[model samples]
Target chain A: MVLELARPRPIWQIMFSTHHTDVGLLYLVFSLLAMFVGGAMAIALRVELFAPGAQLIQDAMTYNRLFTAHGTTMIFLFLLPSAAAVGNYLVPIMVRYKDMAYPKLNAIAFWMIPPAAALVWLGMADFGWYANPPYSVISAPAPAAEMWIFGLKVLGVSSILSSINFVVTILKCKHPDLSLGKVPLLAWSFLTSSIIVLAAMPTFAAALLMLLTDRLGVSGFFNPAVGGDPIAYQHLFWFTFHPEVYVLVIPAIGMMYEIIPRFSRRPIFSHSSGVAAFIILALVSFASWAHHMFATGMSFTEKTVFMVGTLAAVPASAMHVFNFLATMWNGRIKFATPMMFAVGGIALFFAAGAGGVVNTAMPLDFITHDSYWVVGHFHLFVFGTIAFGTIGFVYYLFPYITGRMYNEKWGVVHFILAFVGACITFFTQHILGLFGMPRRIYDYPEIDAWISMNQLVSVGAMIILVGMVIFLGNMIYSMAKGKPANLEDPFGLGGKYYYPFAQRNPQHGEGGY
Target chain B: MAHSNWAEWIYLGVVTALLIYVGAEAWNVERIIDHAPADAEIIIVTGQQWFWTFEHEDGTKEVGELHLKKDHAYKFEVTSIDVNHDFNIPEFVVLMDAIPGRINTVWFSPNEAGEFEIQCREYCGLIHYNMRAKLYVEDV
Candidate 1:
């Protein structure tokens, strides 16, 4: 029973979507499409990386293009949009609002994504994804690279619009029952993540525009040997990149908030503490962007502080982890695959976090900075951690959104295979990295014993791919043939934390502001 | 089901696995002196493009085969003087980079490191792949 907002006549209708639910779903569909594209790119990368001197991926230039596409697509398309989708859906529900205060902007924000995705990646097959066009194939004049940055500009603008809408809605429209103190944990995470996006997206706008201008011969803003340092580009790029990661992770934290409370059968443990930690991490995450520049000759003092700040993240991350654990310490346990993946996610994320610390150390970072170790580290956290967290969240939310129950058995199977395969594929990469394999390299030799490891990684990648296929099969199968949801608590946890918007709570509406 | 509590058990498993992995890698490398003798003279001056520099105790400058006294642990704070380049020798398994404006000091006492080949890694320019020098270790 979707009700269109009939507020302030036609003016408000032009403000936001008629309904935020569809807006949320809109984000979900768009990001899911992106995830598929991003995942395909990952497989292509692994295919090319299977062996040294292997023509499986064409050649050096092609390999570089593949990686750049993969990274850009995964980051810009998959991770960011996934977070936005999760936030769009969950934020309103958590804040006790039926819809964003302005539905018109919500509609606009979401529609902006598809064009950007298509232009940046799908269209880039011709121009190449590299900034330096004619990178791989000679005379293969591809303008895809140009489209990539420009499309990103469009996406950035869209993000800014949505962020403003979410923020205003949260500030003005939360239910009176939900105090800042009483606000659901997921809502707090969303609030912080929205702030992150708002703060960081513009810098990316600046950098991309600079790159675009340079490409067009307007001016080489990034061109060095003319007083422009190449390292500055690295600095600026990571400035956006690092906080951008936090934006992606915050929604995962929100999902964890929803998942943990259900299983624990209790109020969140120390909600205020969790909020404080989020704030600290948000600010600290900004300074640590230079950790990406450890190889770029910044000073010892500079490196020392960044390294210290980088490692200091463990305690903060641990605080949240401990709080989540304590919430469930004495609670009734459910082995639902969603919970399992979320649980596995936190654990595996520690691996990436630990590796992050390794790269944070001045000396260690010097060697491992650009190595495959770093790649493995990020994938472990971002994929094993955040991406896995998303899968779990969506699995739990699937019933609510689709009005059906997935085959739990296959979901579990998919979870284990994908998780195990991801570990096998990525962990071996750390070893290859330590053995002096720089990232984005096309070939590795047989005699170096790297052949076995790369093979294992590729094999693991295939396993994960198969697992993804299985999960997709289950999704289609269940959405079509599965038992219908009882129009009730599909999570079977009753309406303790999650209250459907259809059941309106009166009197407690936007009292604070 | 609650994942937070379950996640602790997961954390326990990762810690055990991490310890095992870290221990194994530690066993393999042991120390800087493991590969070469403590008494052998060696310096790891990581090569960089356009120009070359060293960081030995005697201030590595005067070119033409960096001479070092034998039977001493002479190490160089090897680093890149310019762009990303490495010090590679086919005879020795020790090749470290001199990343621009950064110093990655590697130390090794050459057991038989008499005249080792010091080559630049990537093709930094037209002169890359051919850039090489000889390391002269003295008998003392």
Candidate 2:
């Protein structure tokens, strides 16, 4: 007389699954556009810094606005969302579903991007992103602050809709053959990312709403003049921003799960171990949010908890890379273009992620807090890993979606240049930060050595720009004129490896990749 | 054997280059390069309208050019007199978040002390540049 415990089922399920293919494509397209906008701001900032004194954006306030817009647009609007797009698109494919469990809801979620983007960006045309302050706002007849408020609200609404859809989908639509225990590796990351978005985005949405109301002269809290604590804004803001970083990387991990094994022509090294890593990260997201506040003079107890918890995440993450490389071991390796990007993505992820280890040192953070070094570390992880993973995902999966092959030579060309460009642009930043070059400075002093490192980084950025344009061209052209796909396993993995684990006993003829 | 060893050699070569670069940077141990000695300590508390408010802590209880002891340590506890502004001093390698409702503290024992400039790194308003304040560290 024993009772059986099982995964819970919901009252209703809808199966118009947003196939990972469509979501992945959307993610790539959106990120490319974001890269364009964020890069435009960076280029303007670079133009100002190219020589001492004024350039295209002359006012110091104007320069401040550009940097803010660049960071906000890239983080909130571009990269993390691109990762979400990856999750939305690929989860079903990994889970053996035809589409997302709730397709109509998925449509509702995807459809929300543009308007939300509009909300996040509405003030840019007429006013600087920070135009609504005690500082110099846009003198234009209309107040753009309201527009900004509206735009962010719209985007938040969309994020919430997507979260609801994803939660319902993963919980219900998994194949009967796949228990929660046996869910695909990508699905594990997808579910966790969805959970983070659900828990975190709401805080951001509520805060932005209060800001909107405050701007409108109605106190929705957070105004000390009206008895609201200003520090509260930071508390809420970082609550969202910290987990927001994880929101960026988790999807890339999912994409690597799909690509690495295929490129290596091997089955996954260990399924259960990878799932555990994903779960550990999901559970750890809450405790680590406070590391961003270590310099804000938070109490020693909170600081100690966050510091220990943050380092804990490092070990959990190590399990993932170990599993990935293990999957590649003893397997036939194809240095195909997509595989190269995946490999490069993992390498740079380590490089950037390794430096992030420094931030966990509270004393170190005290010295290098908010310096250009932090900037460098962030980009290395973000542009290096998340962005690279996305581009790699699009390249690897393009044929399946569009039924055409990319020119392998050009794909390789794009990958090498982009990887090299990322290294040049972001790697030098570590040196600049160590040299005491604080971030958000429109200009550095004559004797400051940051000049050379910055100049080199700019060159790297230019290379990345060129590589990106070429990759964009590759995507457009490949879809238009590349070879038509005729086989299920387009990667040409040998018969012994495709079906997983069959390589162990070769004579039975069950081996596949 | 040929292929497997080739990969290991490649890995070794890459690791060696990285180690060399790190060794060089560690040897460099680059430190702050500039020096200054100023006549006063001008405390900057950031505010937003959404712009920065640079004011004295005593609220009109103090006077001109931010007077201070020469060559001595003068503390600046950046309280966000108003909305958030991240006060960053590149010369001092100091950055503090002046959250609207809370206080952020950063201590800098200025070597060979002097006058330094501070600006808000966080975008607070159209006049973020105007959110600028002057700091003077004496050579005590």
Best by DockQ: 2
A22-74 per-residue lDDT for model 2 (tens digits): 44455556766877888788878876765555667767656765676687677
lDDT of 2 at B47: 48
* Model 2: residues with Cα > 4 Å off, grouped in runs: A1-28, A60-65, A125-142, A443-448, A496-513, B1-71, B88-95, B99-103, B111-119, B126-140
The root-mean-square deviation over C-alpha atoms between each candidate and the true structure, in angstroms, is 7.6, 9.3
lDDT of 2: 0.64
Instruction: Give the per-residue lDDT digits (tens) of candidate 1, residues A1-513.
Output: 122221122433323444666666667666777777778878987887676665576655556556666777777777777777777776777787777778778888887888887787665532222232111112223475666777878988988888888788787899877678677778788778788888887887887777666656666455532334445555776777788888877778778877876866766666776887788777877877888765444655676566556655555576577777777777776778788888888888778877876666555653565566877898897789888888898788777666678898999999999899989988988887776565555665444567778888899999999888888888879876777655456656555445563422221133210
Q: TM-score of candidate 1's chain B against its reference? A: 0.62
Docking quality level of the chain pair in candidate 1: incorrect
Where does candidate 2 chain A have its weakest 10-residue lDDT segment?
A: A1-10
Per-prediction TM-score = 0.79, 0.80
User: Residue A218 in model 2: shift from native, Å?
Assistant: 1.1
Q: Which fraction of the native contacts appears in each prediction?
A: 0.01, 0.18
Question: Candidate 1: what is its chain A TM-score?
Answer: 0.90
